[model samples]
Structures are given as structure tokens and as C-alpha cells.
Target chain A: MIGVLLLTIRELRAKKIILGLFGVATLVWVVLALALRLDVIEGSLAGARLFGEEMSGDSDLTDELGEPALGNSLLETFVFGAEMFAAGAAYWVGILLALFATGGLIASMLQQGQVDLLLTKPLSRSKILAGRLLGVSVVMLALLTYLLGAVWLVMSIKTGIWNPRFLLAISVVFVMFMVLYSLISLTSVWTGSTPLSLILTFGLLFASLILAIKPLHEQITQPGRSIVVGLYNILPKFVDVGAHIVPQLVVGETVESWFPFVSSLAFGVVAYALAFRLFQRKDF
Target chain B: MPASAISVKGLSKTYNSAFGKQEVHALRPLDLTVNEGEIFGLLGPNGAGKTTLVKLLLGIVHPTEGSGELFGISIRSPEARKAVGFLPENHRFPEFLTGRETLDLYARMSGTTDMDRANKSEELLERVRLTGSAHRRVKTYSKGMMQRLGIAQALMSNPKLVFLDEPTDGVDPVGRREIRDLLLELKAEGVTLFLNSHLLSEIERVCTRVAILKEGRLVREGTVEELTTQDRIWRLRSTPIPDQSLGDHAHLVSDAQSNGLSEYRLHAADRTALNASLDHLRLAGVEIESVEPLRQSLEELFIDVVEDAST
Candidate 1:
């Protein structure tokens, strides 16, 4: 199992896109660290600058109507906006690049010549796949922590505003990445084609976006509406989680709903279970 | 009696085609036993289930029916493979790893300790003569280099039983000779070797027992000599048989050579008839030099078995 883990790690490390991801992560925080300037006198953010331009410090957190919203000072608002942007970027681009980078691993692992050698090892089938998954998770988690953690640290240090809930975004992004990756694993095991697995994973993700439209339920007829709602309940709610859950977590607000996250977690569990079962029964 | 290294009873595999179109019987129910400290060779044409049998023993694929055991442990259990090493044909190693790294990883996966890994990796590397390229990534390796490295990797565990499939398939003549010598050395160390190879001559030279599979059925199984020996036929090297002794039983295969010895084939019915022919030749003033049973090559026997099965 340790040997398999090391091999998986080595394989992932050899793909330089992952290295480029780390570079992109480092650049994100370094640029943010250098580009933003803040003046904190007596723990109050009296002034802030973007690049070289000055910013007003008295603006209120705005609502959907662009009106000044109630509660939370201007300094807290800046912190919230910055953390939300970082988390959102981590959610979208981070997960996409991660999928592109590691999508083929499961498929490659199942290739005839490769799987033949692996299955002959002294370990059980479950252990082999577990080691491989653990390796991918370890790398992706580290990348997430590096990118999100550094951004959080830079913004917190610059403005003297500490929002610990922003750190939860790391896990949110990581969980979502893993949730989508479960689809990749399942599809790869079923089809043994990396491209096809990746395509279907992205396709599921796209369908989730369409299903997230709550108004579509009323627009459709009886059976179609029932089917839409059924799919919405079944498929991962990437859009809803991104829109509602991730932002709330970033800004240290109470979660409006746990249904999206929970349902996605359930989807991941089923997908991974199916993948392992298929792999075990596969003839290789 | 020698311990059974591998025993299979009624083992078989059937693959269902995609969408339930048709089912392919990959292997017929068969029983086989390989004893300790002997080289067993399996031969067959394409789709003859040679790979299927090896895979079933290694637990790479499950058996559709029947059971198998390795050293008293069922092959269905992971423990059955603890002392087994396999070098699958067209095997792929992690291309990112160096040759030494690949061996160390695979050995560790096989449950070898750190010290044993170090010692075995070094010794096997040197044995396969890959010491210079041991630190180079496997992606840079040539086909023959990969094969040698694979052989070294398979032996890193010092397995009690080893399965080598087409070990010398892509190797040059010299490399093939080296692999054959290495296999012989392993057999001398009291290891059981199960070889699946297309090179019949190699099997004839190294195998103690051979089995030929045709269409997933065991058509023939025996010692190399037993399977190849032509019954009721004997080769006689002697002074030329006189014309009178040249009846149906005894005839000159070739004329006498410079050394005053001729080769004759005697088709005797049995031991009594064979002794009668030798006595008749001797009485006719023909000097008897030697008599030995005639046999076909393993290649010819394998072809006959496969062709006969198809018919």
C-alpha cells in the first residue's frame, strides 16, 4: 500500500501541470500581497489602495439592489468581499484545473498493462485504489490550503481583519473537487477512457447548474417538473453551493442551508462506492 | 513427495460480452498441479487461455468456477500471493520511477522489509546488469532494458514461486540466453517456476514438465521427453546394416560416413521386436554402435496438439 501510494504520488508529481498549479497559487497570493495597500491606525482600516489608486473607506456593504445594506462596518465589508472573491476563485478555477490535471490518473491506472501489474501485488484491490485516491487527495488538499491559506493570511495581515470562517472555504473547495472527482473515478472504471470520464464528469457538473434553477420547476409540466426536481435532489448542487454556501462560509455568516452540501456528499459516496465495486469485480 | 507449489481443480473463466450479445469461454474446467522445485511451462496459441490461467493463479482475475491454491493458501485470498512473483507480458512500470525505485516500491508492496529491499534490489540490479542505468527513469529505457529490469523486479522478493510470461519475448539472442541462464539458476535455488512462453525451444530446454492448451482445454501435458518421444521408433547408430537385415524393421537411414558409422531407424513393434531386430543385425555381422528412442521437437508436438484439437 505504501508502495502504491508512493507510485501514485510520483506519477502526479511528474505531470508538470500540478507544478504549474502551485506556481499559479503562489503568484495569486504574492500579487495580492504586493498590489494591495492598507493603512491600519489603532486597528482601524482608515485607508486602502488598489495598485496605486486610493479607495474610500466609508462605503457600506451593498445589497442585491446596490443599496447600502445594514450591519457590518466598511473595513469588515472589504474583508468579506476580498475573502469571497478568493474563495470563489478557489471554487471555480482551482477545481477545474485540478480536474484537468488529475482526471486521467484513475483511467491510466486501469489500463491493461498497468492494471495487470498492480493487481498482482500482495495488497487487496480496495487498498490499491484507496492508496491512489489518498495520493490525489493529499496533493489537491495541499494545493487548496496553500492557495486559500496564503490569500487569507495576506488579507488578514494587511487589514488587521481576521475572518477564520474564510478558512472553511478551503475544505469547501476541496470537498467539491473530490465530489466531482468521484464521478471521474466511476466513469473511468466503467469506460476505461480518461477523456470520456472527464467529459462525463464535466457534463454532470453542467447538468447540475441547469437543475439548480428553482424557477424551472414551476415552468415545467407535472412529470417533467417531478423529474427536474428529482434530479435536483439527486445530482450535486455545484451552482447552489457556490452561490449560497461558499460565500456565506467565506464571510463568517450562518449557513443558509446544508442541503446542497449534504446531497453532494451523498452523491460522492455513491459514486465512489460504485467505482470500487466495479474495480473489484473487473477482470483487468 | 514434493510439496505442491500450485494446485488447481476444475478452474475456469467465462467472459460475458458487452450488452449480453454472447459469452466467451476463456478457459475450460481443468485440474493442474505443479510441484515444488520444478519448472512448469504452459504453451498455446492466441486466445488459448494461457494468460487467463496465470491471471487466475495470481488473483488478477476471479475464476468463474472452481478453486486454486498456492502453497496451501487459496488464491482467492491476498495472502496466497505473498511469496509469489509475477512478470506479466507487456507489463508497464511507473515511467516516472528509476529502475531501482521501481524494484524497491514493488518489493515493498510485496511486503519486503527495508534491509531486504536494499540487499535484493542491489543484487538483482547487478544480476540483470542494470547497475549503470539503475538510477535513470524507466521512460528512457529501451524495450530490452525494460524486460531485464522487469525480470530483476520480479525476483526482488526472492519468491518461492515465480510466474514469468514471455520473459524473453523482445530480447535479442544474447539477452534471451542470459534470461534462460538466470531461470536455470533460480531453479537450482529450489524455486518453482511457471513459465508461459511462445518460444518452444526455450521451454524444451528448461522445462521439467510442459502443458499445451488449445481453445482453453488442456490437450497435452507431460515431461518434455514424454510428450515429444515418438513411440515404437528408435534411432540406431551402427556400422552399415547389410542388405539382408534391411527389412521393414531395420533400414539404413543414411549411408555410412567417414567414421564408419551409419544412422538407421528401426520401427519396432515393442521391446521384444526391438531386441529381435538388434540381435538379427548383430548376427548379420553388423556392428551395433548405439540405440536410442526417436522423438519430435517440442515445436512439432505443440503444433500437432493445437492442430489436432482444432479439428
Candidate 2:
């Protein structure tokens, strides 16, 4: 397993997925660093927004909306906004890129000439497949860490605000990828087609995001609710999980209990189990 | 002591295709034993179950019926493959890895570690004449180079038995000779080799034993000399043919006056009679050039076996 992991790591590195992820992160960070400026001028929170080096607006806390703020504090607003962008734009784009990049690991590995070499090894097929999954998981985690960490750093360095809560997106995004990537692997194993795997996994992710609405959950009848609940139980709640991190980062408040994490983990375990079972029995 | 490095009894494989609408019997129930430390060649036409047999031995594909043992271990057990290495036909290695890295990866897969993996990888790369290109990515390698690297990968573990399918398929003549020499070196170390190839001449030169598989069954199996040799036939080429060709002891295979020399294929009842006929030729004052036992080339034997099975 370690040997397989080591080779997988080499494969990811050589394929330039790692470098490409870092490049996207760096580009995002540079843009964020230039556009937003947060400062404490004369004991009042002031923010300067720039549009291509031209100051678009200068807002002092008392001057922007009213004398007294009604909703979130300036610090909460800044942190919340940064985390949301990270989740909405950075995280979503990263997942799409990962779908395009890492989706082929299983499909390509299972090709006739390719699988024959690995299957003939002294290890069981399950271990080989698990190693591949864990390898991609590790790469996804590294990419998430770099992209999230860069955003956190730029936010802190530019705005002089450091919220450790933003770092939680790293784990949340990783879990989200795990849940979706499991289906990716399962589909790849079944079809042995990378394009089909990508389409199915991406479609499932989009569907999950739409179904995560609380209003949508409330409107469904008993049987409809049962089917929706069954799907929610097995698939990751992408929008819920991604959007949930914003409020958590802002108020440091926990929401939605442990159901989301448990269900996603269950989804991953079930998908992986199904994939392993099918892969073991596959003729190669 | 174990009798064979590889032993299979009534092993078979049948797969369903077209959504299980059709049954394809890839291999029929067959028994085979490859004795220890001999180069055994599996010769056949395309789709002749040669690769299927190798896959069955490696446990890459499950056998529908019967069992196989590698070095006394059940083929169904992973431990049976612990000391076994295989190079499948039209194999594709991880193209991103360099030649050395590829060997190291495959060596590590066989459970080699640390210093041993490094040493064995370097040794194999050099053995396959890829020492200079060890650091080059496999994507940069030519087809022949990839084939050599495949050889290095198979030998990484210093496996006791190695199955090579089309070991020199895309290799040039020089590379083929080098691969042949490498196989001989492996044999010298007492490694049992199961070679599957359509290259009859290559198999003829190196294989101590050969099996001809037609369709899904083993039609013939024996030593190369045994399979190619035809009994009761002698090829004679000599000058100045006698009008009556050694009486009825010999029969002409072709016209005697076709060339300056007359060629005759003689079928004598025994060695005594064959020597007597040769002695008669000499006494008749016909200048004798050469007399040799008639034998079929591996190609001829393979074609005959497959054609016979088809008919």
C-alpha cells in the first residue's frame, strides 16, 4: 500500500496537478491582495476598495450605512465575506478543476494493459484501489490547504485580521471532495470511462447543492421527503457544508449538529465499499 | 521435492460478453506442468489462450474450473505471486515515472524495500542496457526502450519464475538478441521462464520446451527438438544421381534433375537400413554432399498444429 501510494504521489506530481493548483491559488491571492484593504484609521474601522488601482470607495464605519451598525460587526463582515468567497468561488472552482484533473486515476488505471500489471502484484485488489483513492485524497487535501491557506494569509496580512476559523474550510472542502470523489471512483470502476465518471460525479455534486436548501426540504411531502432524505443521507450536502462554514467562521457558532459530517462519511464509506467490491470481482 | 515450478490441472476460463448474451470459452480444461529451471515457450496464433494461461497463473483472471500452483503455493493465494513476475503483452507502464523509478515502483510492489529496491533497480536498468536512460521519463522512451524497461520491471524482484508475453515484440534484431541473451542468463540462474510469443524463430533458438495451443486447447507440448523432429525421414543432397535411386530404400521428395545436385528424402525402417542405403550411395560412386535427419521448423510445426485443430 505504501508503495502504491508513493507511486501515486509521483504520478500526481509528474502530471502537474499539484503545480496547477498552486498556480490557481497564487493567482487568486494576488487579486485579493490588491483589491481589498482593511485598516484601523484613528481608532475607527475603515476599508478602501480598489478597482484596478483606482480607489472605488472609502468607507469609515460610521460613514457607510449609518452611525450605528445593525447587523454584523465590521470584523465579522470582513471575515464572513472572505470565507464566503473562498467557499463560493475558490472552493467551487477548485472542485471543478479536481474533477477534470484527478478523475482519470481509476479509469486510466483500469485499462487492459495497465490493470494487468498492478493486479499481478502480491497485494489484493482492494489495497491497490484504496491506495489510489487515498493518494488522490492526499493530493486534494494538499491543494485545499494551499488554496485556503493562501486566502487566509492574504486576508490576515492585508486586513490585519486573523481568523483561525477560515482554516476550517480546508477540512470541509476536503471532506466534500472525498464524498464526491468516492462516486467518481465508483463510476470510473463501473464504466471504465473517465469522461463519464466526471459527468456523473459533477452532476451529483450540482444536484446535491440544489437539494441542500432548507426551504426545499420543508416543501416536500412524506414520500418525497423520504426520498430526499435518503439521497441527503448518502450524498454530501455541498451547498449546506460550503455555506455553513461562513457563519461558523463569523460567529464561531456550530450549526446543523453532526448529521452533515456523519452522512457524508457514510456516503463515502458506502461508495468506497461498493467500488471495492466491484473492483475485486472485476476481470481486468 | 516439488516436481514442477508451475502445475495446473484441468484449469479453464469462460467469460460472458455482449451483456452476457454470449459465452466465450477463452481456455478449455487443460493440465500442464512446467518443470523447474527450464525455458518453456507457449506458442500459438492470436487469441490462442496463451495470454489467458499466463493471466490464470498470475491470478489476474480467475479460473472457471480447476486449480494452479506456483512453486507449491496455490495460484489463488497472493503469496503464490510473491516470487512471481509477469510482463503482459502490449503492457503500459506509468509513463510519468523515469526508467529507474518505474523499476523501483514495481520492485517495491513485490515487497522489496529501501537499499535493496535501489540496488536491484539499478542492477536491472543496467542489465537491460538502460543505465544511461534510467533517469529519462518513460514517455521519452521508444517502443523498444519501453519493452526493455518492462523486462527490467519484471526482473526487479529477482523472481524465481518469470512469465514474459511477447518479450521482444517490438524490439529490433539487436534488441531481440540482447533479450534472448538475457533470458539465457536468467535460465542460467535456475529461474523457470514461461515465455508466450508468436515469434517462432526466437522461441526456437531459446526454448528448451514448447507448447502449441490451438483455439482454447493444448494441441502439442514437448521439447523443441522433440516437436520439430520427424521420425523415419532423412534429407540427402548429393551430386550425380543414380537412375534407380538406391532401389526402394529411399523415395525422391522432389525431381532429382532440378539442379546439379539431387535431393532425396529417404524413409528407412531402421538406422541399420538408413546406413546401408548411404553405404550403397557411396559404393555407386555418387559424390555425397550432405545427409541430415528431416525436421520441421517451429513455424511449420505451429502452423500445422493450428491448422490441424481448425480442420
Candidate 3:
């Protein structure tokens, strides 16, 4: 299992896409740091500028009102807005790109020659599969941490509004990606075709989006409504998760509900269990 | 008593296609044993259960019936492979990894210590004459180089048994000889070798015992000499035989050469009769140049076996 982990780490490093994600993360921080020029008058946000223009909050920051008119709440609100955008982008785009990058790995590992070499080692089938998934998860978690961690630092330092709850979005995004990964793994095992696996995974992904629409749930007639709602309960709640979880965690608002997150997690667990069983019983 | 390296009893496999329709019996019940310090070879046509047997032993595929053991450990247990190494026929190492990295990774997975992996990998690289290309990625290596590197990987664990499938398939003559010598050295160290190859001549040269499989059944198994010997017949190269002494025992197989030697196919009812004919020729003053038992080559025997089974 450790050997499989090393091999996967080397493979991902050679591919260089992870390096691009890190670079994107750094760029986000650099742009945030430069764009928000803050004037600290006696340890208060006396003035703030957005790309060389006066930043306007609910009221105003620097003009017409009085001395040091900008309240810390306005600053917190501004930082919260920036952090939410970063969280949403990292959750949506980052997870999508990560799935694209790793979707083929399980299928490739199951190819005839490679699987023969791996299974012949003194490791059990379960350990080998666990090792492969661990490798992917470790790399993805690191990338997400770097991106979200940098963004959080930049926003907090510039506005002096540090909401540690924002860090929870990192796990939120990471777990969501893993939840989706279980589906890809099952697809890869069932059909050893990488393209077919990715297509099916993406197909379920789009279906989840359609299912997340509340209007679709209401408009459907009785029998069809039961089927669509059942489907919604079964699939990963991708769009609902985007709206409820990461954004709420970023803005320091009360999460709408934990049912969506827990149910999606249950979906992931079942998918992973099915994938492992099939992989263990498969004949190269 | 010598320890048994491998023991199989009534082991079998049947592959079910998608939807569980159209089942193919890849292996019938097989009962065999391979002793330590012997080079055992498996011979067969395509789809003859050779690869299936190897995979079953390695636990890459589950057996449908019966069981096997490696060095007293059940093949069904992953620990049975702790001291086993395998070089597959068409192995593919990740192209991104250099030869050295490939060895270290696989050796680590085989549960070798870091120190052992380092020393054995370096040592086997030099042994296979790939020390110079150790740092080069596998994709850049030639087919012959890949084969040599594979042999090195198989040896990194210092295994008690090694299964080599087509070990010399793509090697040039010199490289083939090197692999042959390496295999001999492993055998000298008391490593049990199970070889599966289409190269009957190589198998003939190296294997102490060979088994021929046809249609998922073991059709033939024996030592090379035992399998190929022609019964009650001998080839004699000698000086001119007196026609009277030749009697009905010898048939002329070649015309007399300038050196005055000719070959004859000598028939005998038994060893006593064979010696009697030779003694008769000696009395007639015909000098014996050489005499030996006649036998078929392994290739000829393999073809006959496969064709006979088909019939």
C-alpha cells in the first residue's frame, strides 16, 4: 500500500496539474493583497480602496460622515464577500478540475499489465485499493488547503477580520470531492474504460444539478415526484451543497441544514463500499 | 527430505463472462508438486491454462475449486507470496518512473526493508548489466532492456521461488545467454523456478521437468529425457559393418563418407540384444565410432502432443 502511494505521488508530480493549482492559489492571494489597499488610521480602517477607487460599504468609509466613520462591521462584511467568492470558486471549479484529473486513475490501475504487477505484490487487494485512494485524497486535500488557506489569510490580514469558521470550508470542499470520487471509482471498476467512467460520473453530476432545483421537485406530478425526489435523495447534492455549505461557512452564517451534507455523505459511503467489493472480486 | 516449494491439489478455475452467461473453464482439476531447487517449466498452446495456473498461484485470481500451498503456506493467504517473485510476460512499468525507482517501489511493496531494497536493487541492476541505464525512464528503455530490468525486479526480493513467463522472448542471443546464466545461478542457490514459455528449445536446455497443458488439462509431464526418448532404438555411427553381421538388426541410415564412417539405425529387443549386436559387429572387426539412444527434440514432442490432443 505504501508503495502504491509512492507511485501515485510520483505520477501526479510528473503530470504537473497540481502545480498549476498551487500557482492559481498564489495568484488569488497576490491579487487580493494588492487590490484591497487599506489605510489604517490609529488601528482603525480609516480608508479602503478597491483598485484605486474609494470602497463603498452600506454607508461610506472615508468621506462626508465624520472622523473614522468606517465601522469594523463594514470591513468584516467586505472580507466576508471576498472570502465567499473564493470559497465558491474553489469548491466548484477546483473540485471539477480535480475530478477531471483523477477520474482515469482507477481505470488505468486496473488495466491488465499494471494490475497484474500490483496484485502480485504481498499486499491484499483491499490495501492496494486503499493505498491508491489515499494517495489521491492526500494530494487533493493539500491543494484545497493551500488554495483556501491562502485566500483566508489574505482576506483576514488585509481587513483584520479573522473568522476561523471559514477554515471549515476546506473540509467541506474536500469531502465533497471525495464523495464524488467514490462514484468515479465505482464506474471505473465496473467498466474499465476511463472515458466511460468519466462520462457516467459527469452524467450523474448534471443529474444532481437538475435534481437540486426545488421547482422541479414541486412541478412534477405525484408518481414522478416520488421518483425524482428519491433520485435527489440518492445522488450527491452538488448544487445544493454549493449554495448551503461552503458559502454559509465562508460568510459566518448559520448553515441551512446538515441533512444535505449527512445524506450526501451516506451516498458516498455506499458507493465506496460497492466499489471496494467489486474491485476485490474482480479478476484483473 | 527436500522441502516442497509448491503443492497443488485439485485446483481449478472457471471464468464467467458478463451477466454470468457463457462460462469458460480456464483450468481443470490439477494436482502437482514442485520441489525446491528445481527448474520446472510449463508448456502449452494458447488458452491452455498456463497463465491461469500462474495467476491462481499468485492470488491474482481466485480458484474455483481446491487449493494450493507455497512453502507450506496456503496460496489463498497473501503471506504465501511473501517469498515469491513473478516476472509477467507483458509487464508495463509506469513510464514516468526510472528503472531504479521501479525496482525500489516494487521491492518496497514486496516488504523488503529500505536497506535491502537499496542494496539489492543496485546489485541486481549491475547483475543484469543495466547499471548504466538505471536512472533512465522505462519508456526510454528498449524491449530487451525492459526484459532485463524485469528480471532484476524479480530478484530484488531474494525469493525462494520465481515464476518467469517468456523470460527470453525478445532478448538477442547474447542477452538470452546472460538471462540463461542468471537463471542457472538462481537455481544453484536452491531457488525453485516455474517457467512458462513458448521457447521449447530454451525450456529443454534449462528445465529439469516440463508439463504440457492442452484444453485446461495436464496432458504430459516428465523430465526432458524421459519424455523424448525413443524406446528400444539407438543411433550408431561406425566403420563399415559386414552385411552378414548386420543381419536384420541394423538398417543403413547414411552412405559411407570419405572418412569411412556410416550411420545406422540399430533396433534391439532389449539392452541385452543391443549389446549382442554391437559385440557381433566388434567380432567382425567393425570399429564403433559412436553409439547412443535416439530421442525426439522437445519442439517435435510439443507439436505431437498438441496435435494429438486436438484429434
Candidate 4:
């Protein structure tokens, strides 16, 4: 097992494309966050002018509506700014990172015949697959760490506030990203070609997201809403987890809840086992 | 119990193709044994089931019929593989790894752990003359270097039995000679080598015993001398027309033909009969010039066997 892990690390280290892709992903997230923050700043400043006029004791003197609307304070403005940036950036970042990492990790191994070399080892097939999953997971974590740090730096500069909840939110999103990517990595083993694997993984991810959204539409005007919700809950609804984290971050809430983490982790584990079994039975 | 390193009996394989069910009959219920510490060569042309046989012994492919044992363990058993090393024909390793790392990975896979791994990699790289390019990725290595590295990986565990499938393919003459010397050294160290190659000359130079496969069946087996000795024919060149045209004795078979210099060529079964014919010719007043044995070359032998099997 250790041998497989060591070899996996060695192989991943030798691949420059994986590192380059992760760098591209981090840059994309940072740019998206800055753009979203700029939009939030513009909206908040517009609302602040109305609130300042309403708070001045001159309601009747104002031709504007009664007691101008409550404007966002500096603290509220910054908090809202951070929330907007995190909300827009977190989920997309997770999906792109998951897709890129998962598709490249297994596909590269299969493409380069590294899998054949690994199987020739005395290690059991299961151990080799597991080690590879873990190796990719480690790389995903590193990439997530770098992205999270970048997000924090950008958020602090744009919002002028260092809310620890922003970090917690990024951490939760990163965990969710890891689960999604690990599942995709497991699925990529099914299709031997890189592009095919990537397409299949992304297709499944998109299909699951669509299924998860079906419940919301059904709840507004239709029966069988409970069934739709139940079906959505059973799917690996990463989008729902992202939605949950967004609200939690906006409310500055702690995320020690066991349900979301356990559920995602369980799904990730089962997906990995299934993928490993399939790969083991496959002939190279 | 003469310490046979490899023993196979009744091995067979069949494949189902779109055209029809193609049954190869690779081994055809054949029995073979290689004694320990001998350089045994399995020589044949392409599609002769050599690679299939090697794959079966390595447990990479399952045999449809029959069984074999290596080092007294069933071929299917992993324990047998532990004592065996294999260099598959035209196999590609991960190009991302350096030559040294490739050896290290294979060594680790073979269960050479901790202290031994580093030392073994260093020793093998140096032995294969890749020590200078140890840190260079395998993609940059020439075909000869890759073949050498393949051998080095196969020898990483110092396995008792090494199977090399065309180990010298794509190798330069110098590299080929070096590999031949390496095989000899390994044999000197009491390692049993199962070499499968089409280069009959290489086998003639090194193999003590050989098995030639023709169309997935063992057509010939024995030492080089043993196979070549069958149906021996001698060529005799003589001067004047021999009055004894080799027709008197049934065993003294000869095909006599005259050349421009008053020379006659005679083909006979053996020297004694040829001597008898010569004596008869002398008594009959025919002058004799020279005599020689017509030996069958390995190419002729291989072609004859393969052609005969096909028909």
C-alpha cells in the first residue's frame, strides 16, 4: 500500500499539466471573486445613499419615499460584499476544480500506461486504486488550500473586513469540492480516454444538479413534491450543500453540523469503492 | 527431481473472434521441462504462441486447458511469480519516470523494501550502463537503453528464473552483445533464463537446449546438435567419373553430377559409405578429388520445420 502511494505521488509530481491546470483554476476563481465584489460594492454604495438620507431626521423634507429605505452600514456593506464574492465564486470553483482534477488524474495514468506498471507490482488491485484515489485527493486538497488563501486575500482587500466565517465557508466548499472530485476520479476509470472520461464525469455531475433542482420547481405548483425532494436528496446534490454553505456564511454561523460532512464523505467513499472494483476487474 | 525450473503440460488457449471462434491450440497438449541453471531458448517465427506461452507462465493470461508449475508452485499461484522475473516483448513502461525511478518502482513492486531498494536500483542501473542517465526520464532514452532498462527491471529482484521475450529487440549490435554477456553472467550465477527470440544465431551461440514452435505446436525440441544431426547428408567432390555410381549399395546413396573441371559432386548418407563408394570408384579406375559434408544451416532447418508443419 505504501509502495503504491509513493509511486502515485511520484507520478503526480512528474505531471506538469496537473499543476498548470490547478493554477489556471485558482486564477479563474480569484478573477471571478474580484468582479463579483466590484458589483457588490456598486450596489451597496447605491443603497447606502438612500439609507443615510432616511436616517437624517428629515423624512417629510424628503421628496423621496417615507423615511428613505434603511441603508447598509459600513460593517454591513463589507459583510455583504464578502458574502456576495464567496457565494458567486465558491460553487463554480468547486465544480471546475473537481472536473479538472478528477479527469486528469486517472486519465493521465491510463493514457501513459502507468496503470499497467502499477498492476505489475505485488500489491493487490484494490490497494493500488485506493492509493491513487488518495494521491489525487491530496493534490486536490493542496490546490484547494492555495485557492482558499487567494480568496481570503482578495476578500480582505475588497471588503476591509477579516471575517473568520469567510474562511469557514471556503473550507466547507473545499471539502465539498474534494468529495465531488473524488467521485469523479472514481468514475473516470470507467472510460479509458481522457476526454471521454471528462465528458462522462461532467455529464453525470450536471445531470445530478438538474435532478436536485427539479424538486424546487415541483414545490411551487405541483403534487409529488415529496417524491421529487426525496429523489433529489438521494442524489449526490453538491449544489444543495453549496447553497446551504452560502446561507451559513451570510449568517456567520459555525459549520460543525455532522449531516452535510458525513453525507458527502460517505458518498465519496462508496463512489471510490465502486470505481476501484470496476478498475480491478478491467483488463489493461 | 532434477530441479526443473519450469514444467508445462497440455497448455492450450483459444480466442473468440468476430469472424468465427478461433481456437489456437497453442501448446497442443505438449509437455516441456527446463532444468535449473540452463539457458533454454524457445525459438520460433511470429505467431508461434511464444508470447502466449510466456503470458500463461506469468499468469497474465489464463490457460484454457492444461497446467504448469514453476519452482514447484502452480503457474496460477502468486508464489510462483515471486521467484520469477519477466521482460515482456515490446512492453512500454511509464515514460514519466526516470530510468532510476522506473527501476526503483519495479524493485518496490517486487517487494524489495527499505535499504535494499536503493542499493538494488543503483546496482541495476550501473549494470545496464544507465547510471549516467539514471535521472533522465525514460522517454529520452534510446530504444537500446529502454531494452536495457527492461532487462534491469526484470533482474531487480535477483529472481531465480528470468523470462526474456525478445530482450534484444531494437537493440544495437553492441547492446545486443552486452545483453548476451549479461545473460551468460546471470546463468553463471545459477539463474535459469527462458529466452524467446527469432534470432536463431543468437540462440545457437548461447542456448544449450532449444524448442522450436511452428504454428502454435512444438515441431522440434533438443540441443542444437541433436536437431541438426537428423537425416545427415555429406557432400563429396571427386575427379573422374566414378564407375560405381552409388547404385550398388542401398545405404550408399549419392547424387552424382559433373562440373566443368572434370569434377563430380556426390551426396551420400555417411562417411563410411562414401569411403566405400570412393574405394569402389578407385578399383573401377575413377579418380577421386575431394570430399565434404553438406550441413544444414539453422535457417534451412527452421524453414523446413515450419514449412513441413504448415503442410
Residue B114 in model 4: lDDT: 59
User: What does DockQ give for each predicted structure?
Assistant: 0.79, 0.62, 0.73, 0.23
* CA lDDT, candidate 1, residue B177: 96
Candidate 3 lDDT by residue in tens digits, B1-311: 78899999999999988799899999999998999998999999999999999999999899999999999999988899999999999998899999999999999999999999999999999999999999999999999999999999888999999999999979999999999999999999989999999989899999999999999999999999999988888999999887888888898999799999999999998999999999999999999999999899999999999999999
**What are the per-residue Cα lDDT tens digits for candidate 1 across A66-131?**
754333567778888888999999898889899999999998998877887788888899999998
Give the number of the best model, judged by lDDT.
Answer: 1
Supply the DockQ value of model 1.
0.79
What lDDT tens digits, residue by residue, belong to model 2 across residues A1-284?
88788877877887776678778888887888777665556523555565544342332323234542223456545555556667666557787788778888889889988888898889988889988888888888887887778878887776666778778767777777788889989999999999899889879888887788768777999989888877876777776666665345333555546677678778888998999999988776
Identify the runs in model 1 with alpha carbons over 4 angstroms from their true place: A56-71
The number of clashing residue pairs in each candidate reads: 0, 0, 0, 1
Best by TM-score: 1
Candidate 3 reaches a DockQ of 0.73
Candidate that scores best on DockQ: 1
Instruction: Give me the runs in candidate 2 sitting further than 4 Å from their true place.
Output: A30-36, A41-73, A153-162, A213-233, B1-3, B235-249, B253-264, B268-293
**Model 2 chain B, poorest ten-residue lDDT window?**
B251-260
- Each candidate's interface RMSD (Å, one decimal) is 0.9, 0.9, 0.8, 3.0
As for DockQ, the candidate ahead, 2 or 3, is: 3
Q: Cα deviation in Å at residue A198, candidate 4?
A: 1.1
Q: Sorted by lDDT, highest first, which candidate order results?
A: 1, 3, 2, 4
The lDDT of model 1 is 0.91
| Candidate 3 segments exceeding 4 Å error | A40-45, A59-72, B244-249, B279-286
